[model samples]
Target chain A: MPVQLAIALTHLLSRKRQTLVSLTGIVLGVAFFLAVSSLMRGSEGDFIKRLIDNSPHITVSDEYRQAQRQPASERWPTGAVELRRVKPLTEVRGIRGHPRALAYIESLPGLRAAPVLVGSVVLTFAGRIEGVTLNGIVPDKMKQVSTIEDKMIEGSLEQLAANPNGIVIGAGLARKFGLAMGSVVNAASPGGEVRTLKVVGIFRTGNANYDDMQTFALLKRAQGLLDRPNRINRIVIQLSDPYAAREVASIIERGIGYKAVSWLEASEDLMSVLLVRNLIMYSVVSAILVVAAFGIYNTVSTIVMEKIHDIAILKSMGFHARDIRLIFLTEGVILGLIGSLFGLTLGLGLMALLARVELKPPGATELVFLPIYWGYEQYLLAAGFAMASAIGAAWLPARKAGRVQPVVILRGMG
Target chain B: MNPAGREGSPPMLTAERLGRVLPGEVPVTLVQDISLTIDRGEFVAIMGPSGSGKSSLLYLLGLLDTPTAGRILLDGRDTSGYGEDELATTRLRQLGFVFQFHFLLAEFSALDNVLLPMRRLGALDEGSAQRRAGALLAQLGLDGQAHKRPHQLSGGQRQRVAIARALANDPPIILADEPTGNLDSHAAANVRQILRDLTRELGKTVIAVTHDLTFASAADRQIGIVDGRIDPHWRA
Candidate 1:
């Protein structure tokens, strides 16, 4: 088999000039697969990670009864779902003696829940502070659901714990205030009372929303500032299977008075954007693949016609039509395999280069990084699609060439 | 002796009232009633001017074209009902063809050109195919030229490689369409000798089409075709 392939390859390689067009097409198809697919799937994975980080994956928050009647942007932010707000009973509800009520929510059949206090507050850091959203969080549980630990740029949990008046600033916020680790910050809590804290940590969420206009502190500290020691703004729950969120949320809601909302329901805008982006990428790139497939067909057919006389000679010499077809088909597969593999290498190179590119949203608004990412399945899908199109393109031409007769060819195209 | 039962005289190719009329608004009849039989070992030449249907007739005989009104028998099976695959099978295993020009693949070497037939047939393994190509090339005094492309070879050398290609399957019948038409006299003569040797020494039937009288005169039998009909006076 190897020797046969060698001979076949040698024959094809000899005719490089004639076959080059099709090979180039295949390479282009492969490049499309790698580039577009990487962006789509890469963005998909990133979107999911971001959604989980910045927003609650499952929320029991305040719901407004006449949400649909209200202007969409009123109760919910422009990008959030227009959900009715049903205020939760904020008094600390517990399982064990611990003041964590979410521990009870997490203990349900299959759930992991976190308690949080979120609100906008006026902040002062080195006399250069601004108004930012205060994300009051349970330090231990926040790390589980998000990459908080990995994102921290300055100070440690011990340092944060040591200062009873401690707060963690976003890296952007720290920069804005000209503050550093051990610096102090002051904020008007949710209830409009003043609160001050030492800067124990700094974080960069790889996203401007969290990094620019956000600040974090211990849940206990948040309770003190808000003048609601036993209350929380929201409780977040994560199920064993994310797809079962809506049903699980309902069950939890029936048992508790709070409105339970799944991430899909709450983050509809984000999901749609991510989905549309992927679809667009696939569609645009597929148009390129279609052209490449035609290129393969054109290349194979022309090569077959060019070799008609040779085909006749081979046919007369006891060569089967199937054998002729196989040779051409193999050539097609080879083109796809070579092109895709090369494209993958090229894609990775481009990815590495793009990774270093820090995009600033094309305007005065500044952003640190241009977002892109890909997981294993995305790469496989790209290569798979490329191979399918390439092989499919060659099939017809191979068959046509195989069935050519030695006599007609010898007669010289009559 | 009944001609049909002559001992040691098996017909390798037989055609009965073969005709082909392509479908169209008005069907065009390419060839009319034509009947002929070729024996196992004979060198026959077809002589005709342009549009005399010589090539078309050759195409039908070689299983490359369909007959509108007749049956073709290979060794004896009627070809009227044969499908595309069946025709391809007969062409692959039982016949060989050489054209006026040596249509050797420009991309392949002499050896690969000879082995091309075997590759298409997928019958002979690579080792045997190489061995057979090598022997045929050497027989035509082209062993040293096996590594060269058709373009690199002199006309005569390339024609010899083509002849080797024709003999690749050891088919019983060989077809030639102006085999010497494109070569110089020396190359043409060499091709003629090779065709003649295929019949005389290897016990194969050979048909050649040509306008070259010198080449036609050398054949054991000759048929002159005029306006798609064979002339009675020059039928043999």
Candidate 2:
């Protein structure tokens, strides 16, 4: 080995207690950095997954982003055409040429599109009345585009297809109205149409408001009850790669001239909140490494102080200033290397322990395990940050060591 | 006696009006206007009282400390403009220093301490450097103490180890500051004889600072210093 490295090792080894203390600080710092970051990122991923799975990736609605330009505006092209009191003509509130639009949407690869005619209605059963949202769906297409089929507890969405007037309601709504499978409920639309629809399926999604207010029925029957023939106001789409929704939604809007909004655009506020959460987590975790770096600085500085004579001797023997600096800097590197080794091992163990921890949320029947993301990138990030901190801490003392004058030290000793 | 000595042998080391002042609130001059030359195969001693700057002059000549004014010439090269790294390289290749204390690194074995300069210079591979270090130690009568740490060896043994270290790179010039100042009488005599033999047997130029009259007598020439200036009339 080179003498500089040898001397550095000797110096650190001789001061065993100080070296161990500094090492312990770094070890704990890095371990906690990895463990906490893993948990935070894991939970973030879990939330995004729930957000993506429980909702449509893209929703193409009946409305246009802007009304069609007036015939007068188009005829006079560069002229000032400020026409006042312009009112739209009364017509059915649904997308025109929806069959051709749905065909265009379905042609896109890796996407499942279901046409839904959603309407507000009042349901009365046993003289108990509740306002609810009724979603009209094509059973087979909805099964492909939604997880409601998987959430079914009593009957299937296929039953809604088999029975023309059948409906699927949440378990919460069923319990509130004391309704069950095959029970008939009177549904009244705004057009003064009333229908007695049989409850074919009950689903519980663990969301109280959704369970209490929403129901699904066949598209044709809904169109009949809602007094609109062959009209679907929305097309709900699920993509194989949900993150591609933004690009696909824009393309759909451009192609079909209807407003298509991706889930990412709709939940932009929530995404920003997650980003702020991550930033806070990183800042808090990095503070630990910075504190650990201070311990390293203290230890290395003390070593430099105690070994001034030895430094003088080495310098007198023709060791350059950089060599002296390298000697002390190597001490920091050694400590960082060993500390990171043990820290990574401990961090993995901590993550495993965290992953096994169970928590029972209020009113929940089962315990949910804490999420721990086992990404290799976090390990790399933790180790890189630790080394930077260690080296940074040692820099000042190493510069001091490099600036020592051998003659003065030797004269002082004499 | 410009480039070489009286015998036409090239001067191994030269100092031309060297001065070092500690520049501060009240400037203290450690060495001033010191000019001297010691040719190859010369053994010289500098004798002075305490605080007379004997070690300061030695440091200047060895290039361990830079002169505030004037210059040093080693092997016909002027070194006044050399940077710190260049001076260090020059010292590693051409000069060696032994202090009043043994100054061997405590953590390293005697052999390892001797090998330090050779390792730094890197003129030899690891195997050859190790061999040369062992040979030098054996020649210094430290045959069985090569593996011993500084604290484990006697004072005399440690000083011998330091001498072995100084000779590790085989530099023509070896500068010693009171090489026997910390030794007992018998050990001091032994160290004095070894430094003398280095000039006689190996043709090495040696300059040492000492207060022992007997040690000064063993040198080819003696120079006395009083108050940082060479005193021409003083004799040992």
Alpha carbon lDDT at A129, candidate 2: 95
Candidate 1 positional error at A137, Å: 6.5
Provide per-model DockQ scores.
0.43, 0.72
lDDT of 1 at B221: 79
Residue B194 of model 1: what lDDT? 83
Error of 1 at A405 (Å): 6.4
TM-score per candidate, chains pooled = 0.78, 0.94
Per-residue accuracy of model 2 over A39-74 as CA lDDT, tens digit each: 999999977886798899999999888997889989
Clashing pairs in 2: none
Candidate 1 lDDT, tens digit per residue, A1-414? 542354447656866875677667767766666766766676576667666655666787755223334455665666666456756556543222223346556767776776777777888755565888876777767665556678788875445556667888888777778888888778886567897788899887666666878777887788778776756767767666776777887776666545778888877787888779878888888778778878777776777777776666556555567777877888778877887787677777776776677766522235645455657776677678778887898899888987786654555553
Which segments of model 2 are wrong by more than 4 Å? A77-87, A125-128, A175-180, A190-192, A360-366, B1-9
Candidate 2 residue-wise lDDT at B161:
94
